[model samples]
Target: MEFTTALFYVFAAILILAATQVITARNPVHSALFLVLAFFTASGIWMLLKAEFLAIVLVLVYVGAVMVLFLFVVMMLDIDLDKLRAGFWSHFPLALTVGVVVVLEMSAVLWRGFLTVGRQIHGDSGNIGDTKNLGLVIFTHYQLAFEVAAAILLLAIVAAVALTLRRRKDSKYVDPAQAVKVQSKDRVRIVKMKAESDRVTLAATEKQGN
Candidate 1:
């Protein structure tokens, strides 16, 4: 086997192991670390494929920013492992169904690509690592598909925000509409009190006279 092929297998093996550990690890922090490893390995695989832009982006965006945030959140939060695992069995059926559907969809796409392996649809064959060429191809040929992906990403973002958002009794949040409509009278109350006599002055005057 060629050295590149061997290197590819090595990266793939490490990626698979890291991904497995991400789900299997007992500690959340350890899981986050493994996920970071998986991202790095995947980026290495992308680099081997000559997609340097994607590899760099995977490392910078996922490994550098997203994974660091995940690590920080996992380390900082006081999470109950038992409570988190309690619903795992209950949700397994739904999760499994979703996983199968995703796998089938991915398989379909990969099958189509495999069937067209010999055909080179893009005219520019030399610019493999050029971001400009990639952009041109995406914008010109796959514009609709690109727009659809962007819409899907937007929907996913909204869904994630909606799912994670909860109103906690212990948490305090202000309503922008209410804040904008607030009046000074509602927030502040003025009270008038008569000044008390200075008994120390009276005592000093009495002492001087005595």
Candidate 2:
């Protein structure tokens, strides 16, 4: 086998193992970590296929950002494993049914498709590095779609921040809306008053006279 084929098999095997571990790990944090590993291996496989853009995106978007967010969420949340698992057996039938259906559908698709090993689409094409070409297509033909996606992501981030900063009845927190609505009259008071030094001097003069 060629070195590229051998490397592809190595990455595919690692990807499968990592994916299995992701499902089997008892701890949620460990499962998230394994998922990151799985994503990395998948990126490697994509690299072998010469999908440079997809491979880099799989690693950067999934492993760097999404998995970190998943780990953060899983770690920050209070989860009762035992209580959560209590309904597992009861739900097993439904889960298994869904799983089996998905598996059957995937298997049927695979059966219909012919498998060819050692065949690459690029096949040593000088333009194997299609990252620049992909970018041009995206920014030129799909510019509107790309802009919309970015807008959606920005809105999601803003919404997340708003939700996180929302007021809670039990917490001692200031309402930003109320604060913003406040006039200078509500926030400040102007009073005529003598200086402390003047007040002290007047008091001392009165005492000496007495």
Most accurate candidate by lDDT? 1
Question: TM per model?
Answer: 0.65, 0.68
Query: Candidate 1 clashing pairs?
Result: none
* lDDT (10s digit) by residue, model 1, range 1-210: 999999999999999999889888999999999999999999889888888888889999999999889988988899999999999999999999999999999999999999987775463864545677788888988999999999999999999999987888999988899999999999999997755566777878899999
* lDDT for residue 178 in candidate 1, whole number 0-100: 98
Please give, for residues 1-210, the per-residue lDDT of candidate 2 as tens digits.
999999988998898898899888889999999899899888888888778888888888998999999999999999999998899899999999999999999998786665653445432353444877666667877899999999999999999998898667889987689989999999899998889999899999999999
Quote the positional error of residue 167 for candidate 2 in Å: 8.7
On the 0 to 100 scale, the lDDT of residue 120 in model 1 is 59
lDDT of each: 0.89, 0.86
Model 2 pairs in collision: none
